[model samples]
Target: MIVEHAVLRVRPGQAAAFETAMAKARPLVTVQQGFLSIEVRPSCDDPEIYLLLIGWDRIESHRDGFRQSPDYPHWRALLHHFYDPMPVVNYYGRSIFHD
Candidate 1:
């Protein structure tokens, strides 16, 4: 599995707007191929920071396939404005972790 982690720092006073946008925007992932699951969590220490965690079957499923789809443009239009300075997205594969 591929793990994609993004830290979204919303602009001040735009938290509600960002959350509402995400509610409408997140479904785009479901329509695409190779989607596993996703989670969005608000930071306890920083209210403006949101943690976006997504799991994909393969890295290409998101990095290549999803970005190439026409829907991404619409997705970008809907959510890109919410970022303060734009979030940095990082990807990783399982190395070692257990519960």
Candidate 2:
């Protein structure tokens, strides 16, 4: 599986709205081809920071497939405006693990 990580730094006081929008956006990604799962978690250390973990069967599904789909625009519209400096998104494949 490939994991896409987006370290979202939402503006202060915007966490609740960001989370609410993501709740609605999550299902859109779930229905896409090669989607495995989606997870969103708030940072304990920094309340304005949120971590998004998305599982995909292949890298292209995230980079090419999802971006090409119509749902992406909707997803962007719902969640893109909350970013403080905008999130940094990157994908990873399993490489090392302790457990």
Candidate 3:
């Protein structure tokens, strides 16, 4: 399996709204193929920082699948505005502990 990691830095005072929007957007992703799970955690030290982790069957499942699907535009519209400089996404696979 592959894990998608992204650190989202939301605009000041918009954390609540961002979370709410994320809730609405979650369904769009859940319906996609190869989707295992999605998780978002808020930083303890800074409310604006969010840790996003998504489980996929493979890297292309996200990069070439969901991101290419019609729902992607909707997902982007609902949540992209909240980011200031935007977030960088990275992928990890086959953890050593489990391997």
| Order of the predicted models by lDDT, top scorer first | 3, 2, 1
Model 3 misplacement above 4 A: none
Worst 10 residues of 3 by lDDT: 90-99
Return the top candidate by lDDT.
3
> Model 2 over residues 1-99: C-alpha lDDT tens digits?
999999999988999998899989988899999999888888999999989999999999988999899999999999999997987889999869858
Every model's Cα RMSD, please?
1.3, 1.4, 1.0
Question: Model 2 RMSD to the real structure?
Answer: 1.4
On the 0 to 100 scale, the lDDT of residue 23 in model 3 is 98
Model 3 steric clash pairs = none
Q: How well does model 3 score by local distance difference test?
A: 0.97
Over the full model, what C-alpha lDDT does candidate 2 score relative to the true structure?
Answer: 0.91
lDDT of 1 by residue, 1-99 (tens): 888999999998888888999888898987889988999999999888899998998989998988899878878988989898888889989869665
Better lDDT candidate (1, 2): 2
lDDT of each: 0.89, 0.91, 0.97
